[model samples]
Target: MLHDIGGQAPNPRQTKIAVVGGGSTYTPELIDGFARLRDTLPIGELVLVDPAAERLELVGGLARRIFAKQGHPATVTTTSDLDAGVAGADAVLLQLRVGGQAARQQDETWPLECGCIGQETTGAGGLAKALRTVPVVLDIAERVRRASPDAWIIDFTNPVGIVTRALLQAGHRAIGLCNVAIGFQRKFAALLGVAPGDVHLDHVGLNHLTWERGVRLGGPEGENVLPKLLAEHGDTIAGDLHLPRPLLDRLGTVPSYYLRYFYAHDAVVEEMWTKPSRAAEVAAMEKQLLEMYGDPALDEKPALLAKRGGAFYSEAAVDLAAALLGSGGSPYQVVNTYNNGTLPFLADDAVIEVQAAIGARGATPLPVPQLDPLCAGLVANVTAYEQLALEAALHGGRDRVFKALLAHPLIGQYAYAESLTDQLIAHNQEHLAWA
Candidate 1:
């Protein structure tokens, strides 16, 4: 059993929260998350921040409706001012992605020309995004430090593991959250025709780049069913899904992310084309959804979530947050927290995801005893490059940035490392403002 730090649920009371980037499509889910916990974590006030007034109002309005409908008396405020949003809050959530989806697509695609996978969440794409995001995220961290000195930051940004590592190294209290692993686990269980709870998993490593070491179904009684289920039921579930699972099934190990690169290894370009075509597929799916229906924007309105009246926050997002706040109950989650040697397979200082127990003391990442060699090597390599990039971001220099780019396994030891480095830098030079 996992430990629960929150001794008991706090009584209903006002709690101030600052949600940065309120205009994001994710705001409604966040607001709903708070509503579900209102009985224990009463909302005193909510501060919403965004640049566009109209977008801010839309999300802010939705937040209000959720709160009112839940019978919570929390006051909601919208602002374009950054400092005002950070002031007097118990917690702050950072959810901004600098260049949006189009920019991300470019970041991933350009790296494909070189025969490497171009995903902004990991590898060289992760480094490039870190260069662009560290400054912005840190700026928000600074505001939280000054305005709400004791507040804990919940980061929902991409490259979450790397970003969370940077913040903690800089002496800020923060936790980065992602649900990719959980999403995949559920998909796998459904493929095997088992209840999600009936499936047990061992997950480790960074966001968008972890591996499931073991899987068991049916608990002690169901232990005998796993092999047969793997042999027969696997096809049904694998066939229904349109993701990396099929590859994972063939390898006899769950595929967390490496599968994307497996199928499109030769399409990698330079830095600008780093995102894999798999992302393009997801975009294409979204576009097809829009076209299939009469609407052009499928996600413009609310989405049909997994649970009803569960929370506004994404199911994965809420699971992490509520676990930290002591209101959630999930078997396990691999979240980004300060690496205090949780994953022995990697460096102690390398931030990673292992099992975690969230309660009164906040998220407590558990230790991982062992890991698959492939996953360990990949995470270590990525973390090495990522740490160098963080250093470059902190102390602006071409040398540090180049060193980081060259250190990457995909880009390292290649004759074109210098030229590729130069071209990549030139393409994403806007990121140089920070480095």
Candidate 2:
């Protein structure tokens, strides 16, 4: 990848931002961020777009209350009309779920029946989500493009790499955002007795398939702290990764939690069969969260949002939006952008999540140190599979789905691929128009 080093001052101006999936239980978390970071982002208007009227009412009301409670000046609005919602927006955030938790339940369950990881952003299940989500998201992106040509799309949707790639492929001004990298930076910063701002990670690889090969303190070259973190907090770290400390010590790099679906695939699959799917758990949490949101007195985000996952999501989203919209902050942040020869192995067109300096022109991948063979091998394999998965998601067929499953590292067996293809299609028939 090519690297350009520089800094630019942010032009202070009021912004009108739209949250495409505003009814999501996660919206409050984002609203809370906006309220706290108001001095930085300075929102003029905030719109929540969703087809669910009741959810929009509950979420929009609570969002307004949160801003009011924080004494924020932004006005919050709710709407089902995409064109109206995105009209004149400076930036649009996408976080939609195609079939809700019921569909997610199917994605998480059927994959385990074929002995594959059931997570929503990594393997077969993630592919199912991509297939159902891509078309809807593209349509939304098109509306944003039409309504406001200069609008920047910040995607927080699942299967982020695929969705971001689809948006970019359609010539939309977009960038992908994920919490995994920031979550690690915050954790490492806490352990090192420093502010999260002091830590910068060599977070590399495709979405959900990345690793922190190096952790630099103060600046990109300040000091390497990955060894120190692994040495002192190895057990706690290992528990979070669900991998052995010895493996981390051996590799001398910390992998993202999603890597567990790869390093310990069979174990995860076996263990998953014994528990309720994450979708079921999140669905129940949303039920309680919506109830809490309906309370007029509850102005702050519920504590239960932490259990809803996406920790530090609002901060990352705000940071990215500010940088993308020219409220310049840090010089670098982990983002999903075009590879542009960053890996030297993957196609330039392949979207890889890496550190990049954000500007109004969008992200340019930072120069990366040579990757170890082990990491490169897994990244290359998964990137190829992601290519096929995106193709299948865009143009569906039983054979294409089978092809995607067969290419997955966690489901390489022909028998497993065939069975998963049949079961996945059957389970997702409602969402899969092609099926």
| Tens-digit lDDT string for candidate 1 (222-249) | 3534345446655654443324445646
- Candidate 2 runs further than 4 Å off: 1-13
Evaluate residue 32 in candidate 1 and report its C-alpha lDDT on the 0 to 100 scale: 72
The lDDT values for all models are 0.64, 0.88
Total clashes in model 2, counting residue pairs 3 or more apart in sequence or in different chains:
1
Candidate that would win on lDDT: 2
Please, what are the lDDT tens digits per residue for candidate 2 over residues 270-363?
A: 8899988899999999999999999999989999999999899999989988888877556688999999999999998899999998888999
* Alpha carbon deviation, residue 227, candidate 1 (Å): 5.1
- In candidate 2, the residue pairs with backbone N, CA or C atoms under 3 Å apart (3 or more residues apart, or in different chains) clash, namely 1-342
Full-model lDDT, candidate 1:
0.64
